[model samples]
Target: MIEVLVVVGPGLVADAGLLEEIAAREFAAAGVSGTLVRARDAAHVLSLLSPSSPEGVGCAVVLPGRSAEVRSLIGRDLGAVVWVDVERADGVTAAAGATHLHGRGIGGLAWGIRHAVHRVRHPSRRIAYGPLPEQWGELYLPGADELYLSDADGPPVVMLIHGGYWRSIWAADIMGPLCADLAGRGLAVWNLEYRRPDLHGWDATTADVAAGLAALATAHGSDALPSGADGAAAPDLTRVAVVGHSAGAQLALRAVADAVAGEAAAADGAQAAEEDARAAAGEAPAVDGVRVAVSLAGVLDLVEGDRRWVGTGAVGAALGGRAPEGQAAPPYGDASPLLRLPLRARQLVVQGAADDLDLVDFGRRYARAAERAGDEVTYLEMPGDHFDVINPATPIWQATAQAITQALAAGPTSRG
Candidate 1:
């Protein structure tokens, strides 16, 4: 029996009563009992989780702003923390080891509680690939027998890259539902939280994605992702898919291209030597190991996006300047997924016909360009919006999921 604790922040007392009601309903639905505690600050919450406290809290549902307060208790056998309404500084809270739920407002509490229960039952791990606070990913593993979506080797691994037009305010939490859904379907889910371009420079964002995928490739036998629960086999990294939504599609496609290029360079000793020299000069290495890349209503063309002032100029802001005129140059040349075609890896490009005209246009063009460049591409353009593709319950996402499953089943094709 797990004892859940719902902690309300002092500043959020107005919603305390509603929080209690929702907690009760959620607890009942989860078949768990909980205690709602009104705390003044982090110190008060800490005192409640202390050994001297009467209530044994196995899973905690914490409010925003105070999530960092319980950071010290993480990985200390204190229990899992589900931080709700996360934003901005919440990235640190997530890095501190709490499962964060953002942007859903009061509705996020429902998912937060669900996440806490999953953590207590399945026991996911948040492993950091880099020393920075934002360079970490949470691995969610499903029961072995529950793998309805698995192949002969094992469950396919899917790394989710969330997108908020590459803004810092949009962390990995937005991908929570999708992560949970994929895991429930028996796919190992890696929900990554990276340093966004807004606060940590564009290069940092791209570097973190590459490094995160590299970590996933070796996660099977490493401490980064252990066989969960009953020692179920780790996910088959050899058959991996990178799924990105909205702006994340850009990162996903770019990473695939970089990896393919990296592999080719590695095979050529002279090219590898040059790349090593470039690495010594501080250029980060490209990462490999992804078999398929899925883009959901992705902002795939940086030049077009910047030209359209999409996301109110989010593309330029993320790439650090307007699209280079005459010829693609600098950030746009390397950062734009459309500019880096023939990604080599199989691609599933999904776009909503009703999404922003720019995104739909970009998806259509990118898919055509990729196919022209001799890459395997499946273009699925349906009726939906930007976010409909992310919602698991939506028809758009169901079709996208089926496409991803098919792509992963096909396995990796030789780039040569």
Candidate 2:
């Protein structure tokens, strides 16, 4: 009998036990079955896999969105691990690392049902922008719009990062109408879809965010994609800002902070000699490009949100219960925009007082903290609900547009 370790990252956790039952069948069919243990994050799974032995577990079944982490596992039985992926059907396919688990047995079947319902309820014609199948963004609008920026080589791209509390259950596809609105208004839009915490965790989600942004940046510079299929304009990443809602707001802020942290450190080396020494020491110059964050009712202060809503456990789910240590690198500190302050670019936070009380507090508190940290922070408190801010038909979206316009006018800066 083979011991099967069903590593339930963030994705399978969303399946609500359906995938567990399916996995049992898969293992039974393969004549490998003993104990079906459930593991949370990769760290926990690795710990249980036996520190003394490399191939401890008979076989490990990793769920979706964990391809990156699973690929990174060290000293594991390469041939015994199976990655759970979903394409057309649910069956175990061949993969370079371990084994590939594919087919409808995937939790995507459940997602398909819900996604279908959502697609119907929220009608949108936004396209998915990606060369890879997993990496897709809801097309709000492409590079060129009916009306380009009044002053620029081309319209700036407004990458839309939707918020579902960083959960896989909440997809970027739900932000269709909002993307359409932005694209319709002469803005290039890329509604990014990332692997939520379900399959892997925050690490995967954050990595996807970086990859999606890079893909767009590459696409912008590539001559291959001159225009959209409809012959619309191509996005210009040289002048780009992120318009993120709720949890996505926090991510956008973090990206800006991470991208500019090096520059901020270099700025401390005020003396030319020190700067020259650092450069001689193989230090890179601060990246200069279009950078700004437009947050819509975002949960910027995760530390505060976790404390207030301790019962709900939303923050724990996003950060894997890794509490902030006042000053640390990842798992928590990197996740919190409040801690990653002193950003070089401007941040326009359009918060709604009528939203969740914790989220509201996050917006207000984050704005104050940003100001204290010398970031160009603009906090706007409007009379709207959480989701209302993303609606183009509403006045709140107009405020978002205004913020974007200002950021575009200000243009790019090398303050990082």
Best by lDDT: 1
Q: Write the per-residue lDDT of candidate 2 for residues 171-278, one digit (tens) a residue.
A: 565576676666667776777877777556777677667656655655555552355435655556677887788888888877766656644555687447645853
Off by over 4 Å in 2: 1-133, 139-145, 150-152, 228-233, 262-288, 322-329, 414-416
Q: CA lDDT, every prediction? A: 0.78, 0.62
Cα lDDT tens digits, model 1, 1-416, are 87788777656524666877888999998788898888777688777766567777788887644344554444344445776663334443443556556656676777788778766765567788888878888888888777745545667789999999988756676787788777877788888888889877888988899888878764557767777545667777777899899889889888888878878877876676857764774445544557788998999999989999999999999888889787899789898898887788889999999999889889999999999999888999888999989888888888888877777777577787
TM-score of each: 0.82, 0.63
State how far residue 66 of model 2 sits from its true place (Å): 25
Q: lDDT of model 2 at residue 129?
A: 38
Error of 1 at 115 (Å): 4.7
- TM-score between candidate 1 and the true structure: 0.82
Model 1 off-target regions past 4 Å? 1-5, 13-37, 40-44, 47-58, 64-78, 84-96, 99-122, 148-152, 218-221, 228-231, 274-288
Best by TM-score: 1
How many residue pairs clash (N, CA or C atoms closer than 3 angstroms) in each of the candidate models, in the order given? 0, 18
Give Cα distance to truth, residue 79, candidate 1, Å: 3.7
